[model samples]
Target: MNMSSNMLSGPKDTTRTILVIDDDSNFLNPLKMSLEEEGYNVITAENPKSGWESMEKHEPDILLVDWELPEMKGTQFIKLLRENKDHNARYVIMVTGHSTTDYIVQGLDAGADDYLIKPFAIQELMARIRVGIRIRELEKKIKEEIKKLTVLEMALSVADKIGNPISAAKLHLQLLMEQETVKKSPELVESLTSLFSMLEEALELISKYQKIKEPHSVPAPGGKTMIAPE
Candidate 1:
């Protein structure tokens, strides 16, 4: 796909909040406007201090950072952000004139998730930003699903361990052995006494989990509420 098309064609219900950190208003202004036009929420910071503050406040979905700044370079900024555990989820794309592999590696090591060289095409930048955002979204979804699976697996394991019918059988067997020692009739005392207690206890434990039977869910009134065609 072409650059702009690829950048703009993600699922529409979700969009990233982008932070553009560059002192060059000429670059920052246009990029911000374009990103906003494409349905992203764009926030801009003109200096390093302001950028850090914006990062803290907005906790942006993605960061577009200039490689060189008057006070602090982009690599250093990214390093600081990475070291802070709270900002670990922030995705960064370095904006720089340097296009070397070494520079790219430095950016990545400093926790830049992506990179875009300065004077780069707006379409290309947007495409990279789209990629960063999509990766983060997918990662989040995967983590959530894993959490749910872990919980379900734990529940099933507990059920398996505690729900065995052998527990009830063991209790009955112990009671029957005691009755036998006393020379009691197996049919009259052993069977009746042991089975009754086991069944009663099992039923009580089972009742704790079974859903309370509610009245049947009735459909809404008004003849099922038909809708007219548009």
Candidate 2:
């Protein structure tokens, strides 16, 4: 592979990271400068090896790779990169001289999100980068929402796990407080019985949640509804 190690870099910051893989110094150096000026942390690699490492290390949200590379082609790199679950969501745009229909299809089939031809204007590239930024932000937002939903579901599950028992104990206590016999009974005996019953009730509630039940589904008007076993 006639790969060059002439890497031009920028300081890391809160800006979005972009990995550009191309064996051409003519393209790599200029692209890096343009991207850096636009407030993006750019990682450039002349070979697929260093590109892959930078990808895994930097976790770039956008990729601008040439179709032709040293030993490994752009499609090959993307094929291998997509296999790793961690990089499946990367926004890839091919930058090469090959703009044929077949090559574009092949690149897209290999998991590239978009493509660009060589000798393209810097302004156009900037516009595409902006689009990539928007897309990455949307993906980040969706993931955060999913995380919040998971936390809410967990909280509800926990409440469900403990809600019934606490309520039952409270009702029991109210009954005991209102009853004359229980209120007048030896304070020590009443306290011991009440505490023991509450604990037993809580254990029973927890066990109920632990038991596995067969799910039953019924066809609704528009969808299927699941009924939990009682």
Candidate 3:
């Protein structure tokens, strides 16, 4: 059955779908029941084909996949899902007997968001689920903020990139006028023009300072040239 897009709204819901893909019925059943008892809708598949079919039919929010399956390797299954555009939204966690760091790295490289070693604590598994949900929410909020900032930055950048100096000057002047209107600072306009002139003088002074060198020699008594002190 196609799970409603609105069904997995959040933690408040009565049931959240989780698809467990493990060839071992003993492990899969217990894990599914544990999550179901915690108010999640659980589905189990023994192979990648069934798992993919379940994912397409139910649109599960989370997929718990075993590292070893009879039909295909766990990493390969995950890679296939990741390469499919439609499956990109599903959050997959790998369950594996391979507990070494090398295996974990391989799972991540294959695009698993997280992994659980075989014989995981039920409580810890649930906690991981909560963390994943919270992270997804935070990620969504950050992406939205980034998008807004990108739009604003692009606008400012385009204004700065405009080639016409007159257009640039007009933009700056208009910005100053807007600021003055907001603050009611009529004198700011004159102050800014004066400040610009002062800034030009300051820049010239800096250039002159850079060009300055110690006098070649100091005049000594009897018109003798004395070398400058080192």
Per-prediction TM-score? 0.67, 0.71, 0.57
TM-score for candidate 2, residues paired by index? 0.71
Error of 1 at 76 (Å): 1.4
How high is the CA lDDT of each candidate model? 0.72, 0.75, 0.71
> How far out, in Å, is residue 145 in model 1?
1.7
TM-score of model 3 relative to the true fold? 0.57
Better of 2 and 3 by lDDT: 2
Q: What is the alpha-carbon lDDT for the whole of candidate 1? A: 0.72
How would the candidate models be sorted by lDDT, starting from the highest? Answer: 2, 1, 3
lDDT of 2 by residue, 53-92 (tens): 9998999978998889999889999998889898878888
Residues 159-230 of candidate 1: C-alpha lDDT, one tens digit per residue: 456666656665666666566554566566666666667766765554443322221222457755211111
Clashing pairs in 3: none
Q: lDDT of candidate 2? A: 0.75
In candidate 2, list every pair of residues with a backbone clash.
none
- Point to the candidate with the largest lDDT: 2
